[model samples]
Target: MENNNFLLKINNLKTYFYLDEGILKAVDGVSFKIEKEKVLGLVGESGCGKSVTAQSILRIVPPPGKVEGKILLHQKNGSAKKEPLDLAKLDPQGKKIRSIRGKEIAMIFQEPMTSFSPLHTIGNQIMEAILLHQNVNKQEARVLAIDMLDKVGMSNPHRRIDEYPHQLSGGMRQRGMIAMALSCNPSILIADEPTTALDVTVQAQILELMKDLQAKFGMSIIYITHNLGVIAEMSEEVAVMYLGRIVEYASVDDIFDSPLHPYTKALLKSIPKVGKKAKVRLDSIKGTVPLPLDLPPGCSFYARCGQAKEGICNKDTPPLLEAKEKHWVRCFLYT
Candidate 1:
C-alpha cells in the first residue's frame, strides 16, 4: 500500500547498460522518497546518475540500459482508494505509461530545442500533450496552451505560441518548455538542469518562476542540478550523490551547515566563498572518478576520501544510515 505522505518512493533502483566491453552501472542501488508538494534537490557532478535516475522513474532510459527495482507512484483511484503503481513494471511505450508520464509526472528536459520539433510551433507541442491527457479538443487545447505560456511569463503568448522554437529567445524557449511540462497540471515535475543554459539574470527569473509555479500548482519537484547555489535557494531537502549512490541526504540547512559524508564536505569546501581574499585558489576535490565498468570493491569513494582508513573503508560498502534526526549519510565514520 502507498502512503499518503509520499508522492513517489524509489527503492534500491539499479539502472545498468550492457556494453561490448562491460556492463556500466549508471544508477546503482539508489533509494529515496519524494514528499508530497515539496522540492527534493538531487545534486552531483556529471555522470553521477542524477539524470539517469530521473529517466528511470519514467521508464525512459535509453536502449541497452536495464532499470531494476521499484519506482512506486502513490496514485489514487476513482473511488478514493489508493493503489501503488510500480512504474518500473509498466511498459514504456504502452498506453498506461504514456498516459501517466506527462499527465501525472511531467519532465522539463535539459534542452528545449532538442525536446521540441522545429517543424511545429510551440503551441502545437504544448497542445499535443494537453489533448492526449485532458478531455479537450484541439481549439480548447490551444487556448489552454496559450494560457499556460502566459502563466510562465512568456511575452505575447498568443503571438509566441505560433512562432517556431528557433524564433524565440533562449529564456522564452525555456519558459515554453515549462509551459509544456505544466500544461496538464502534473502532480510531480522533474526538472533536469532547467537553468543550465540561461544567463544569470534569466536564470534567476526562471528560478523565481519555477518556485512561484510550484506553490501555485501544488506539485512535488525533483530538481536535478550540479549547482549547489541553486539547490540551496530552491530545495527543501537535499540529496548529495556520488558515483550513482546518495552519500548524504538531509535538510537544506543541515547540508550547508554540517555535511557529514566526506564527499559532501569536500564538495561544500570547493565552493568559492563570497568574502574570500582575492587570488586565493579554491579547494578542489582530489582524485578522479573511478570508471563505472571497473568500480573498486567496498566504498567507491574510498580513494578520494581523505578520512578513509585503508582496511575499514575498502573492506565493505557502507549502507545509507540515519545518523541524526532526519539526516542520513553513507560513510564508515557514521556507520
Candidate 2:
C-alpha cells in the first residue's frame, strides 16, 4: 500500500562535525520533503554536505559527527491513518533505524569499490543483504541476487555474481551496488553520486537504469551529485546546496530554465554546451568553496555570487523564502 503523501520529511537537519579547529556544520538547518515516487536532486560542489545530508538520513554519520533536527518518515499503509516516524530522534545504533535501513530505505554509495568488502564475493554480499532483510533461504537469496544482477543489465549474471569486487569494471561495480541496494525493493533510495566514476555512455545507462527501476518499483530517490547534468537528467526536484545550506530549491525545469539563486545560475552557466564554438573558455563560479569549519556568516555563496547585493549579502544570513509556488531561494535579492 503506497501512500501518495510525503514519504520523507526532513526539517532543520543539522549534522555537525567536531573538528579540533571548531565545529564544521556539514548540514545546517536543511529541510525538504519527498513524495512516494519522486527523485530529489541534492546538487552542490564538493564539501557542500550533499553526501552528509544523505548519510544523515540513514544515520550513517561517522563518530564525532553530531546530528540534530527532525527526519520524519511516513510509512505507506492502505489507510488514511499512516503514522509518521521521527528518524532523527531514534538512537543511532538502535534497531528501529536499522529495521528501516535496507527494508524500507537503502543507500547506494558513491564508490562501490570502497563500499564492498574485498574478501566477499558479489553473490555473497547481495545474498547477505537479502537474507538479512527478508525471511528467505540462502538459495532463494542467491536466486534473488542473480535476478537483480540481470535486471541491472550485468551480462553473465551468475558468473559475475560469483566474482570478487576487484574482478569487475567500475561501471559493473556500480551496477552491482545498485543491484544490492534495490534487492529489497526499498521505498526510498539514496544514491550518492551513483554515476561519478563512469564514462558518459555508462553514466547515461546507469541513470536510465535507475529511472527504469524507479518506474518499476515506485520508489522515491534522493540523488546526491556535484554534476548538474546528472541532476537535470534524473531529478524532478532540485536543491542547490552551498557550504552546508540549501541556497536554492525548485523543480528541475524551473532550475535549468530560470535559476533564482546566483550559485544555481553560475552552475548552469558553467556547463559546456554543444555547438558553442571550439576554444571558448568555460565560465566558472569565481573563487573556491570555503572550508566548512570557517564558513561565511551571511550567505556562504557571497564570495562567488556575481549578483550579490553589496553589504546586505555579507552581513546577515538570508532565510529560505518561498519565491513562488514550490520554488524557494535564500538570497538577499529574493528576500
Candidate 3:
C-alpha cells in the first residue's frame, strides 16, 4: 500500500554488479522512505553502498549492475498520474526516466566539476536541464537559470553564469551546480557528499542554502555523507548502513543517544567529541572492512563486530527488526 504522506518508498532494493571475479552486491535489500519535506540521511563509512543506493533510486546504476525490486515514487495529490511510478522498472536511457530525472528528481554530485562541462558556460549547463524538462524556450530557460543562481546565493549571478567551471572558486562552482539542479523545480534532491570538496565555511553556507531552499520549495532531500555532525544538523531521521545494508534506522536523536547496533555505537564513539584530552587519539572501528566481492554467508558485519557471539551472529544474518518504537536494528543482540 502506498502511504500518502511519504513521497518515495524504496522496497527491498538490491543492486548488484556482475564482475569477472564475482557478484558485488552494492545495495542488498535496503528499504527506506522519503517522508514529505523531510531530510533523510544515509550515513556510513566509504564503500558502504551509500552512493549506490542513491544511484539506484535515480535508476542510474552503470552497465553490468543489475538493480532488482521497486523504487516507487508516490505521486503528489491530483498529479497527472495518480498511481505511484516505479522508477526501477523504467529503462535507464528511455524518455520516461529522463522526463522524471531532472523534472521530478534531481541530484547534486560530490564534485561540481565532474558534472559541469568545462566546454560550456555555467548558464548553458543550468539552462540545459531547465529547457529539457520545462515547456520553455532558450531565452526563458536562461532567465530561469539566472534566477536559480541568485536563489542559491551565487554572487553576481548574471555575470558568473557565463563563466566556465574553472573560472569560479570551489564554493561558487558548487552554488552553480545547485542552481542547475533546482532549475527544473525537482521535488526530491539527492545530495551525495555535496559539501566535502569545499572548506568548512563554504560547507556551512551551502548547507544553510539547502535548508532555506528545501523550505521555500517544499523539497524532500536524500543526503548521503559520512559526516555524523552534518547528519545531526540536517536530518530528522537517519539510516546507518554497514557493508551494503542498513543496520540501524531511527530518528536522529535516537541514533545519537540510544544506538542499539554495535556498529552504530562504534561509529558514534569514533567521532571526536568536545572536551576530549588533547593527547588521546580519536577512536576508530577495528578491523578493515572486508571486500564485498563474495559476501560471507552470515551477517556481513560479523567479522568486525565487537559484541559478536560466535554461534548466533556467525551462523546466520539477522533481519532488521523493530527493537523499539520507530527504531529498527539488525543484530543478534536485538534479535
Candidate 4:
C-alpha cells in the first residue's frame, strides 16, 4: 500500500529501449514520490534519463520501448475515496489511460516548436486540449483557452489566440504550451525543460509564472532541467540522476548545502558562482556519460565518479540509503 500523503508514486521504474545493438536502460529502477501541491526537480546532464523518466510517466515513450514497474497515481473519483491507479499497467492507447493523461496529469514538452502543429492556430490547439477533457462546448472552450493564455502571462491573449505557432515568439509559444497543459486543471504537471530555448529574461518570466500558477492551482509539478540555478528557484525537492538512476534525493536546501553523492558534488562544482575570482577557470566534471549499451556492471557512475572506491564502487552497486532525515544518497561512502 502506498502512503496517502503522496499524489504520485513511482516504484522501481525501468524503461528500456530494445534496439538492434542492445537494450538501452533509459530509466533503470527509479523510484520517487511527489507530495500534494509540491514541486520536485529532476536534474542531470544530457542522456541522464531525466526526460525519459517524465515520458514514461505519461506513457509516451516511442516504439521498441518497454516500461516496467508501478506508477501509482492517487486519483479522486469525484467522491471521498481516492483510488490508486497504476498507470504502467494500463494500455497505452486505451481510454482509461488516455482520459487520465491530459485530464489528471499533463506534460509541457522541452521544445514548444516541435510540440505544436504548424498548421493549427494556437487557439485551436489549446481549445482541442480543453475539448478533449472538458465537457464545455467550442465557444466555452475558446473562452477558457484564452483565459489560460492570459494567466500564463501572454499579452493580448484574444489577439494571440488566432496566431499560429510560427507567428508567436519563442517565449510566447512556450507560454501557450503551458496554457494548453493547464487548461484541463491537471493535478500533476510534468514540465520537461520548459525554459531551455528561451532567453534569460523569458526564462525568469516563465519560472515566475509557473510559481504563481502552482500557488493558485495547488498542483504538483515534476520539473526536469540541467540548470541547478533554476532547480533551486523552482523546486522544493531535488533528484540528481545519472545513467538512468537517481544518485541523490533531498530537499533543495540539502542538495545545495550538503550533497552526499560524488556526482552531485561534481555537478555543483561545475556551476560558476558569483563570488569566484576573476580569470579563474570554471570547474567541470571529467569523463563523458556512459552509453546505455556500454553501462558498467556495478555502479554506472563509477567510471565518472571522483570518489569511487577500488572494489566496492566497481564490484557492487550501492543501494539508495538515507544519510540524513529525508535525504537519500546512493554511494558506498554513505554505506
User: Against the unseen true structure, what C-alpha lDDT does each candidate score?
Assistant: 0.87, 0.86, 0.86, 0.88
Q: Of models 2 and 4, which has the larger lDDT? A: 4
Strongest candidate by lDDT: 4
Clashing pairs in 4: none
lDDT of 3 by residue, 229-285 (tens): 788878899999988899999999999999999888887876533223211132555
Residue 56 of model 3 has an lDDT of 92
Q: What is the lDDT of residue 6 in candidate 4?
A: 83
lDDT of 1 by residue, 139-165 (tens): 999999989999999999989999999
Q: What tens-digit string does per-residue lDDT give for candidate 4 at 1-335?
A: 24567889999999999999999999999999998899999988888898889889999889899899999898845432566889999998889989988799999987897879999999999999999998999999999999999999899999999999999999999999999999999999999989877777788889999999999999999999877778898999999998899999999999999999888888787653322321113256667777778576788888877788888899988999988998999989998
Q: Higher-TM-score candidate among 1 and 2?
A: 1
Candidate 1's displacement at residue 43, Å, is 0.6
Report the C-alpha lDDT of model 2 over 1-335, residue by residue, as the tens digit.
12336889988999999988999999999998898799999988777888889889999899799889989888644243566889999888999899889888999987898879989999999999999888999999999999999999999998999999999999999999999999998999999888777776777789999999999989999998777877888999999998889989999999998999888887787653422322223267677777878766777788887787777888989999989878999988977
Candidate 4, superposed: residue stretches over 4 Å from native: 78-81, 272-283
Instruction: Single out the weakest 10-residue window by summed lDDT for candidate 3.
Output: 273-282
Candidates in order, TM-scores: namely 0.94, 0.93, 0.94, 0.95
- Model 3 segments more than 4 A misplaced: 1-4, 76-81, 272-283
Error of 4 at 82 (Å): 3.7
Each candidate's root-mean-square deviation in Å? 3.3, 3.6, 3.2, 3.2
